[model samples]
Target: MTLSSKLSAARAGLFRSLGLMFIAGFGATVAFDAWGQIVSPALGFANLSPHGLAKSLLGAYGLPNSDFAGYFVHFYLVGLIGYPLGWLFVFRPVWGRVVRRGGWLLGAAAYGFGLWILAIGGITALAGLPFFLNFTGITWVALVGHVLYGVVLVAVMRAFGGR
Candidate 1:
């Protein structure tokens, strides 16, 4: 293929990859809701869901929000950014093999680290915003949740790759 054709092909492939990854991510959200929203409350983990998870996972960068709209907006931004990140994190390894066999794990860890940093950075940048700035617990919540996200991503990558 000519360079232009190759670029077009690559773009198409990226779109496809992002679509698949987005679906996977949405599923992750649902699974998270199932446990945090449903099971957690039942198990007395009422406040141990995303709120806690984001704070813990995000660490210093973790911005905390209490309003449902705020929560969705924050995650919406994360999901949007995460779509492209999936390409950097997963595509090269699974498709190009640019990384080693453990690329998935590394990718996941990097992603977790990214979110952790985002938690602190996002909060700091938006500290003036009343919605999330007040929620000091965002650190713990994001930290824990992103850890779970990283862990699950690693598992899914392994399982899917194995299959």
Candidate 2:
């Protein structure tokens, strides 16, 4: 192909990949939220408030802590971009290299577990909360939610013909 044509093809591929990532991320986040906010609560588990945590973290840094800011950070930054990018660029690639078999589901679950660690172990501390929320019921709920997020993310990507 000519140089211009090659560049155009590359650009198209990039956009496609990005679109897939966003879709997958959104789906996974929605599942995580549904379980944390709705199903888990109905089952007598603690409800997750990731946005609230986001607000607290922002306020701790003297930034805007409005509901809008929290939702935007939780849904747009982390859900639509951060997690998906991490899956596409980091976890998926690394998992493929490490497993070399039909173990994407397990790899995705492990990724979710890592995300839980990041949130409970890292983010909570940053937000000035007791580390791991003192290992309360919410911590365990969040663990399941994060794992569901990972599984749903990979499933969505796979459905959309992505790795």
**Candidate 1 Cα outliers beyond 4 Å, as residue runs:** 46-72, 83-103, 106-110, 120-125, 128-141, 154-163
Across residues 29-129, which tens digit of lDDT does each residue of candidate 1 receive? 55445554666556654333443334443443455544553556445545434533554465444644545665566666566666555555564454433
Lowest lDDT 10-residue stretch of candidate 2:
95-104
TM-score per model over all chains: 0.54, 0.96
Candidate 2 C-alpha lDDT tens digits along 1-163: 8999999999999999999999999999999999999999999999999999899899999999999999999999999999989989998888888888958799889999999999889999999999999999999999999999999999999999987
lDDT assessment of candidate 2:
0.94
Q: After superposition, how far is residue 53 of candidate 1 from its true place, in Å?
A: 12
Candidate no. 2 TM-score: 0.96
* Sequence-dependent TM-score of model 1: 0.54
lDDT of each: 0.52, 0.94
Worst 10 residues of 1 by lDDT: 46-55
